[model samples]
Target chain A: MLLILPIIVPMLTAALLLLVRHRGVQRWMAFLGSMTHLGCGIALFRLVQSEGIQVLQSGSWKAPFGIVLVADTLTTLLVIAVGVVGAATTAFGFAGVDPRRESGGYHSLFMVLLMGVSGAFLTGDLFNLYVWFEVMLVASFVLMALHRTKEQVRAAFTYVTLNLLASAILLTALGLLYGQSGTLNMADLSRQWSTAGPPPLHLPLALLFLTAFGIKAALFPWFFWLPASYHTPPAAISAIFAGLLTKVGVYSMIRVFTLLFQRVSPGIYTLILVLSAVTMVVGVTCALTQRDFRRVLSFNLVGHIGYTTLGLGLLSPVALAGSLLYVLHHIVAITNLYLVGGIFLRVRRTTDFASLGSLYRTHPYVALLSLVPIFALAGVPPLSGFIAKIVLVQASFAQGVYWAGGIALFVGLLSVLSMARLWDESFWKDAPDGVDKASPTWKQLLPIGALTLLSLGISVGAEPLLDMTSRVAGDLLEPSAYVRAVLDGDG
Target chain B: MELLFALTAGVLYASGLYLMLRRRLAQLIIGLGLLTNGTNILIFTSGGLTRTNAPVLAADALETTEPFADPVPQALILTAIVIGFGVLAFSLVLAHQVHRSSGTDDVGDRQ
Candidate 1:
């Protein structure tokens, strides 16, 4: 019951806050709800570590008949990540969005989006996952369009259309899976998949599922919608979207590929490997040409997602662990950088690198803050990002995938160069004329500060986190434990 | 019967894909509708067809039964139908809003 509360509380709060008329009250309520949710997530993490996996069967119905919210080690970590990021984004939202420009609807829609994201991370049923995805999409649509600027409206249309198409594909896939397997319960599907011989629909079913999640994860060909649409939104929303949303796609990819699909056919893994390499190279090359700070970061995000997919493509335990840890590290680091960029935009009044300069002189603390995560993103030593990349490269080498490892290392070097470009162009040069001298308020600084502190914490605590990630990878690779827990409802 | 359902699904999918590729919003809506119908039929056929019997048990029925239509897929498709309807309605409203705001029905023009 307690395992489910982190998801439930936010949803209830989101619904409750929608009824409140006052903007200030709504903000505070959302902040409080997010904090409580984070607290619960931490508690849930501890509880899972102390006990084992926590399974809460909704409505007390049996596993196949009712929805279940299961919390394993990986889920516990992801829940905490979602909670922390959700809370930070909410606080950042309060500081960044002007309630006068947009109604209190921003806060409300944000809460709803938070609820939907948390729900998607927590649910254990396939159809229920679709429901949560829709919840997230609806909230995201409203949030993306809240300002209703011409650019935003146009961007939102593309975003909505692509996601809706993905959702349609997802539905078709689900229908096909249910038709063949007669169960939408994830645990049951895994069981049925293992024992059942190759059905007539196996290849098509896999392709359908792959295509649906491929769009969300923004892998090679499907990723164009992302860089095009992301830059049109406000900085705060874009930061959160950049940090978390695509990772949800990556999460689904990891979940489905490992737990559901179980084994990637040799040919498919080759294709995936090729896609991962292309995604990495193409994304960075795109970033190299971008002059806008946000656009550059957005393209960089696409490249980083490839590192995660590459780890999975390697199929080594260490590589998979590295991928999971990289997802966690990237989420924190990228969110920090994006939020810091938001502050820069606030001060400089533009995101174009040509139009902005010399932030280190006036806002030394902000500059330093931005520099830490940017270095980490470059895979500089003593940061969690370095440890994650080291593990991935070592894993790939151990598997004799030297080409993949070499490309990954080269990509890491390119990332460093890209971040250096952002630093040299934005913070190191002379200040632009007529720029505002206003400092970031504590409200704006708080979220970035909290996120930066988290990145440093990851740096300091890299060993323990790595150990946990390895254990999670081991469990994921041998998924009988997960299947048993979901099926038998035991720890 | 299975062939009929399969053909219906194929036609719906073909037309749906064509409509979806069109630049106009109305065609997109029509495409989505057709796509969903195709999906529903696919779901129906994937569950193996039965002669005439449904999977419901009556009070006066015997314990033994044969040749019943698979109830599971029907239940699953029912749920899919409701969800599909929700998505359609949402998309319609979304398209309408985009049309109203942009004063254009063509996706290409809006872009």
Candidate 2:
């Protein structure tokens, strides 16, 4: 029952929120619901850790035929991250989201979004995954266009159109896949694929998966919609989008590549590696060119996805663990940065660096809060981001993937430059006269404080996190158990 | 039969892409609809079409007998169509809003 709770709690909350008329009730309910969802996620993680992967086949239908949910360690970890980020964003909405947006079913759409994300993480069937993607896309597109500002509607349009194209490709790929193999279950696909040798149109199918998920993840060339659109939303939406949304794409790639299509082609990995390096370089460099603080952070988010996919591209245990670590580090650091961006907006009354200044002069505490995640993100030591980068670099070097290692190091440097530009322009310069002087409310700070503490906690307790990732990486590298868990070796 | 379906899907896809690249919102929406239907037919054909049977087992028949069309692809396509319809409806509404607010549906005219 608890296995199903993560999806259920949010859906139920969202539905209930729709009926309630009072704003305060809706707000507290959304916050309480998010915390409950987090509790379920942490418990689910513990259950998976103690017992191994958990599977639920809806309506007693067996795998390869029924709708199935499997919570392996990787999925479990991502679920926990989702819960943490979801809760923080919901809390942040208290201070940041306009009441009009809330009245427009913002909380409901948000829960549906989480439900989709969780379903994607948990589902065993490929078609089920597609359905979940649609769920998430509709929710996110609506959220992007919630304000119906011209810029936001434009952003939503681009985001929706590209994503729908990606969806068509994925469906077509599934058709091709089912034409060849009779099953859609991930575990079943893995077993049949290995037993039958490589099927026809394998590379094309893999490329289809890559194209679909790539747009979602904002990998390299397909990443334009991301930076173009992500900043259009206000901070709450941007924070969650920056954290959970693209990571699902990365997760799907990691899951599918490892479970069903391991070594589908060495050519694919080479393409991935090349694309990832380019993604990293382009993402950070573009961040340097942006003067708007949120836009700079959004660009940074695009670039950092390269590192997680880099782990998948390398396809080694230590490297995968490092990539896994990088993702965890990123979810906290990036989301928190956006939340802090809201604080900056509140204090300075603007997001543009040219007009924004002197946060350090008056609100040193907010500046200090912003600094923690910024440094962590730039791969500064003692932070989880530094540890994640070091591990990835070490793994690349150990595998003698010199190009990957070099680029990881290079991106770390450029990251510092982008972050420092924001700090110097926004915090170091003197506050311009007659700007709005209201400090951040506790409602806003509460979420920032929670996420700031989360980043610190992940760093301080980095060992357990690394251990869990390495353990999960082992399973991902050798997925026999995962296949068995899903398929049950049914004839 | 398979070849005809394949050709139709291809032509629809090509046209869809072409129309989608156009600036007009109505054209793009039509393109999206065509693409959706094309993919639906593609899945149906790829799953191997059948003329005479639903995927039901006869009463007292424990198993699906004598080459009923595979139901899964139909199920998948139906899901896609429903989802596509909802999305198309939303896209149309959004387009109307875009046009009303911005006074043009040209992609270039969007903010």
Clashing pairs in 1: none
DockQ of each: 0.46, 0.73
Off by over 4 Å in 1: A100-104, A432-434, B60-66, B100-103, B109-111
Clashing pairs in 2: none
Error of 2 at B111 (Å): 6.0
**Model 1 per-residue lDDT at A292:** 87
Interface RMSD of 2: 0.9
Name the docking class for model 2.
medium
Question: How far does residue A12 in candidate 2 sit from its true spot (Å)?
Answer: 0.7
Task: Give model 1's docking category.
Answer: acceptable
- lDDT tens per residue, model 1, A364-391: 8888778778888888998878999999
Instruction: After the best TM-score superposition of candidate 2, give how far the Cα of residue A64 lies from its true spot, in angstroms.
Output: 1.4
Per-prediction tally of clashes: 0, 0
Tens-place lDDT per residue, model 2, A1-491, is 67788899999999999999888788788889888988999999889878878988888898878988999888888998989999999898888577678889998999989889998998989999999999998999888887777777777888888888888888888988888787788888898888887688889989999998998899999999898888778888989989999999999989888886785677888788888999999999999999888999989998999999998899989989989999999999999998888876777666888777877877777777778898889988898899999999999999999989999999999998888887888888875562756888988888888888888998998888898899889999899898887777321
What C-alpha lDDT, on a 0 to 100 scale, does residue B95 get in candidate 1?
Answer: 76
